[model samples]
Target chain A: MNIRTIITGLLLLTALICPALAAKELSGQEILDKSQKLNEADSRAASMEMKLIDKDGEVSKREVRFWSKGEDKRLIKFLSPADVKGVGFLILNADSDDEMMYLYLPAFKKIRRISGSAKSGSFMGSDFSYDEIGSTGYNDDYKAERLDDENGQFKLKLSRKDKSDAEYEQLIMWVSQEAFVPTRVEMYKEKKRSGKAYLELRKVMTAEKITKTGKYWMPFSITMEDVKKGHKTVLTMSNVKVDDDVPDDYFTQRYLQR
Target chain B: MKRDKPILCLCLLLSLGLILSLAAPTLAAASINGEIKLDERAYADGSSNQISWNRAEFKLKVASELSGQAAGYAELKLRTADGPDVSSLADLASKSKVSAYSLELREAYIDIFGFPLSNLDIRAGKQRIAWGTADKLNPTDNLNPYDFTDFLDFGEKIPTNAMKLTGYFDNTTLTLASLPVFTPAAMPSTFDSSINGYINAYLPAGMTLVSSESQLTLPNATLGNSMYALKLARTIWGQDISISYFKGYDSVPNLSNLTLTAVSATQMASALTMTYPEIQVLGYDLAGSFNDIGYWLEVASFTPDQADQTVISPAGTTTTEVGQYTKYTVGWDYTFTYDIYVNQQWMHGFFDERGSTLSDFLITRIEKKVMDDDVLLALNWLAEYNNGVVGNMFGPKVSFYPADATEIELGGFNITGAAGSTLSTWANLDQVYLRFKYSF
Candidate 1:
């Protein structure tokens, strides 16, 4: 089946399942704005470990330390495979639906750009394809459908504008009724059960007066499981300091290599 | 006749009933992949030069994993190249000789997941087997010699026709392959010559080629139609190190000696007919990854059928007093930048002293990506200074992606130096290649 066809069908199904309704029957932009506040308002660095167990019970594990300055900028460093200890990758939004990334290979002592189709590949041999994480900013690529309310929460399903963007058919999210924060996301690929992940708020240490008091509970951790296989990946966010004033230059390839 | 027809009808019904009973439902996943290319080249010998569409490799794969203790998968691949039999250089080098536009079954294999033993895996049918330790130049890729100019699609095209049995236990793998049928085919490098010239000049009489060399002809000759290979490997030192051993059958040409007086006058270039002797190779491989550095070494020895006088050319014959010929290569790959890679390798031949001497070879390459993860550039240089003969090759490649997920690559290669003299330059222009790919 065509990849685009799968995505379109999956998204439309998700939209129908979750009635798109807001307080004012808000426009797409308004709904996105509500969700954007939750992701953009907080940026923290965290160290995480992920494990994937294939259906055959083969387990592959990866450990990473991520440094995030904002919604769309982050640095990830591999900590295992001693030879690759210092190797890292920095991702920065170049534009909507497009991100620039640099990889630092310690053995070559040079930072290189991984161009083209490599982005859609698995990240460090993990089940999570690189495009999934690299393209976290979805505003420019997806057309959001606000589904009906369930327990005072708004549910939205997103459909990709172009097939080349990712391997996913659709993304379904459940937002809190009062906070407008996304609590869970189900990712489907080719109409097959690919992965289902849920986000949990450990605690909201502090909330700035900038906007959205109810959105203070940042998802401190996320756990995902492959629906068809016996595999799961968990990401825990720690070192929860935000707005540290990180400069754009720090995200350059030169700094990443060092 | 009436009784026989009833029996036949009953047999057909029984066979269909068995097939349906054994048929199992399987899960399948598919991907869409292709590549685009833009290239430029200036050949050393400026012969045919054309810049045009470099066709795409479009494939559709439907795979399934059955619920029964068995599973199988198959794929269909097609290319954009035109004509009924125009061989794409890359495709020609690969085992897939079917026209680019021609659609063919890529893979079909059946496997018993948990057979007699939980750890034992038995797979029968057409399969691809990768042996040896070398990454790009695996002597074990011997199932099919890959043309580097082509992308890694050779595996999809030139899968070995054999049955494989593999046992996995505690990070160790033991593999055995048996070839019930083997066909002798010529290497891609020998495609230009006439069959007569190839038979007389390139192929040794007794061995069989796995693929036919000619694009226009069917391979009707069969020799040693059976072959077998065994491979064993185990991970050690916390999975940082591994070693493997492989032994397989290969064909080599040898000629029976005839006195000048014994040959008839009519035997001009055909004065002495060639015979192929069974050639066998035993190989050993070792690889280790320590921290950021990885090293690999592989050695193989070719043992001819017998030690005798043989002629490479009509003018003279060399006696194979040496019983065996050995070739070895060792290399190190280190990753310094997150995305940059470098490698250095050295190879030498330790022939039985009496065999044809192939000069030592050295290779070095450094690759780095640039231009916002949209462009990749690489440079490589090779120097082979044989005893009295020297050859050098230089190549540079650049790949770019206009979109985030597709790539187009262009590459050029140049060769210089005389075959017999170091000072004389015979610069041959290798064609420029443009490749574009899309993947799902």
Candidate 2:
């Protein structure tokens, strides 16, 4: 063959090998790990507003303040809606095998323990389930596989390593490569995509490079749609602060009464 | 004397309000919020149909950053009802009488946190102290009195003048409270005429029932008559457990002295006296969850001081006796798919005079969201079985939220039971009610 023919063949080979090399560089599991790190911090505090909309476009609003330390403890207090103000919820991930939750209602003036079987139940009557909001990290519970790449975004399919431990059988995530954050996620009841719920993260905010950890991206707005029920919930977060020092007693049951 | 008590109470309440308002500006961060509720109920029997319009309330709260650990709160309610005297504007002046319904201080308390220790809190005021794990029927709950005039509103607890202290540990808490005043349950006056008629019909041959009066003997307002309570609560292995001790007077009065005076061949005057006896109670409660079901058990043993009951017979003979009792309750609740909740409870009363008796009840509540979460439709049914008598009350309500600050509720309650049963006494009192509330 002439030199021109050899050059054409080399060009074709390089074009095919470059994408394979890039694919091998980061597996889906590694991408998920990096995304989690970029999204979560050691401690966080935020004031959030939740808007619930029905199929007919009716809306109701709720306000809450949230605090979380590490990956295990979280506290949420209702701040608005006179009937439900002063209601609190506390969650503690004690060990890998178990989790503890408590609820405080102002009318009852008592703290009550919640059962683990409610993981699949709605969170505060919202479209999001308890497990969805209580999840610490996805890597520990799911086995990930790279699906495809489109428009500078990587798509991954995750299957629960143990089916009994999770509410959803499968989840598909579309992650943005630039910010290392998941832009959209679809949850399936079965292994296939017959019954699915959709979640979208919008209006992401990133911290400036003033902190030692540099810039970190967080979703300021999130929408969860229950396709079967034709219901949707939008959560808008404001006044968010990361790496703030949370009191050690904030996770206790007594704090719920405060 | 009876008519003057309410006026005196109102004057005292108004003076207290003025003082609190004058002192509010001196605090650090003060806020106020409350609701105005208007309720109208139309009874099927038309015996006690009424409309209450002036049910306004405001809660004032103040916190001081100077001490960084002190806060004060007070809630005042102003209420009035339109009586059945006026039907039109022509009778509005002379025929109509406007009276104050209730001017109540629901809560007036000062809370001091981090007192004496890092995790200790003390509250002294006229406040409500709710205890126990059961839903509405708590044998271990004795700190507050109840307003039984409206049986459907069992959740309302009357606040008492008290001093409370709570100490917190890692997973446990200890609470102690002293209630210096005795408050009795407010009973409905609907039973007065019925009880008088029954007593007259059962009288002996030589005696005819004249006017009968029932008097309540309340304990003297003294420090020795004050109530004291202690509770220890802890969480272990995901279960909440508590032990409680209470020394107080029974909120319910028992029939004691019966005297027949002014006796003649065809007429006799009857006087029945009711007394609240002091009692001591030891209680234990436990609550836990299994899967989606929640369960609780509350047990209380009561030892009351021997109370003498004197009965004067038509033959001019007198007899006396004494009485005592114990109570227990077990309850469970579960939520089904579609947000249907079911609660079941069993209560037993061991009376020294009447022996042991058991009562079973089940409450089913179903809620549906319409118009997003803005409108909610709730249906509640309470079925009770006591003393081989079955009774049920079904309430279906629809609440609409025009805005975040306003709620309108339309509801109806139907009560039914067999004759001679407890529920049958108010069988004709089924009502359709509408409530409009606005909060700020």
Candidate 3:
């Protein structure tokens, strides 16, 4: 071969190899972990508004202020609706075996530690369960498998690592390619028949709004719906501040009573 | 308490709230909220349906936060209740014109989040200081006295004037509180007759009752009558374990002395004096969950002085010594499949039922929510055993949420037991009630 012909062949070969390197696929767990890292912060403070809509189209609204520090500490206090105002919750080491929760009832002026199945129950009659509220990410609780990439989104199927410790048996997630965060999630309940296990669709959570803040992208508004029951809950966050000063004592019972 | 004292206190608090509102510009942060509720009740027996309560209440709460270190909260209640039912439209119009409404200051307190120490907080004012991990029926929660004006509302406590200090550390907390004076708890209207029977059981034979008249002497407002409490709590293995001590007088009065005189050969005049005796309690509680079942255990050892009554009678003089006693409660709660919730508690004492006559009670509740949690149905049961007598009470309620921050409930309470038993005394109180509450 002549020098010009050989150079042309090399150019073509380099072009083929570069695309292959660029198209290297990522494992499901890697995607989940990267997504988790993208969503994490040293601290977070936000004002959250919740609207619950029943099948009859009746809507109930609530407002709250929330603060979280590190990975294990979080506090929430109600801000509106006189009956529930001053109610607060403190959470520590959530979504783990050592999780602890304390609830303060302003009406009773009592602070009570909560445990057991209460975490799996509905949160303040909303569609979100306490478990869902406390879950920071799915990487630790689920075994993820890459399903496919469609419509510029990475699809994943996550199955519970341990059924006894998880509320949902399986979840289907659609992550945004640009944001590395979940845009939609479908929760499935597990059922067993003749020693065989299966899953059924139970609830769907969709991110309605996404905003970029300080090189990170987050869901600013989300909606969780129970399809079978036709019940929907929309949660919207505003005034979100992250990676700022949050006192460790803010997660204690003293701050909860405030 | 003087009938007008509550009103005067309400006026003073209102002025404070008004000033707080007018000065909101430089007060850092302030908020005001309130609620209104109406309740009505009727008896269940046929042909004699009598109204028990026609109460309307409005509660107002004001709160302020200064910078990031201090906060204050105050609540007031305005109520019109227990007046004669309107027999005609004219009665309804004229009854409101009279001074039948009463005002009360429920709670007022200021919190110093971190001063003098970064981990200590001081709360001072007239407020409810509740200390316990159990659900309601807590033996260690004694800072405030009970409020039984509405018999169906169990575990309700009246706010007492007090000051509290709390010290916090890693996984531990210590609380100290003091009340300047003693306040007695309110009881059901029929409780006097019931107490008469209980005291008579301790009297000698042939001491028949002339008139059911009893007098209660209030504990003097003195430095010695001040109430105090302390609790030291720590978290161990995700469980809240606490040891507490309380020095005060029992909120419920007991028969301290009785007198008997022979009017005729067979007729006897009997008089009884009720007084609150001094008491000291040492309490321990463990609250945690095993698996998916939440459980709590609390135990208290009580030492009461003058528990036995001194009897001076024409027949003879009898003095009985009251001994030390212990009270305990064990409770467990779980939410089963389909969102059915069940809570059960077994307690060794009820109210002032102490000494050798202490009763053991089993209280249970089963509840479920339906229609997207807009409706709730619950059944409450209580079983009591004292000596060999057994008593029971059942309460069932259905609550519906028709709007946000509003609730309507229909409920009933029923009791059954042998005559002269504690439960039987409340048998005549069986009734059905309807409540409407709205919060704004």
Root-mean-square deviation of every model? 19.2, 6.3, 3.8
Cα lDDT tens digits for candidate 1, A80-111: 53324557887665333345455776433334
Tens digit of per-residue lDDT, candidate 2, span B176-221: 9999889987665564666576556546776777778789889999
Q: In model 1 chain A, which range of ten residues has the least summed lDDT?
A: A201-210
* Candidate 2 per-residue C-alpha lDDT over A1-258 given as tens digits, one digit per residue, 9 for 90 to 100: 999999999999999888657655888998888888876788878898888777878787878898888888888898777766778988887324546778888556667666565555666567876666635478777888888786768888888787346656677887777667777777776432456654432212112222223256767777888776677888887888878788868898767876
TM-score of each: 0.51, 0.83, 0.92
TM-score for candidate 1, residues paired by index? 0.51
DockQ rank, highest first?
3, 2, 1
Docking class of 3: medium
Q: Using DockQ, give the best candidate's number.
A: 3
Q: Which sections of candidate 1 miss by over 4 Å?
A: A1-258, B1-44, B50-56, B79-104, B140-157, B189-225, B238-248, B251-268, B271-277, B306-309, B312-322, B349-356, B421-427
Superposition error at B356 for model 2 (Å): 3.6
Instruction: Write the residue-wise lDDT of candidate 1 on B1-440 in tens digits.
Output: 32254355456457635644555331222212222232233343465564323455555433344454666654445454433343466545532244334343455567776567866767777665555554444443344323322321221225546787776665466767776654343333323332344344433443333333222222123444456667666645522223333333332233334222213323322334334434566777776544325567777766755535544433455555546777777788764533576777776651212245656667788777653334778877667767867777777888785543456778876777655532123244344666666543
- CA lDDT of each prediction against the hidden true structure: 0.52, 0.71, 0.83
Off by over 4 Å in 3: A1-24, A192-197, B1-21, B85-99, B198-208, B211-215
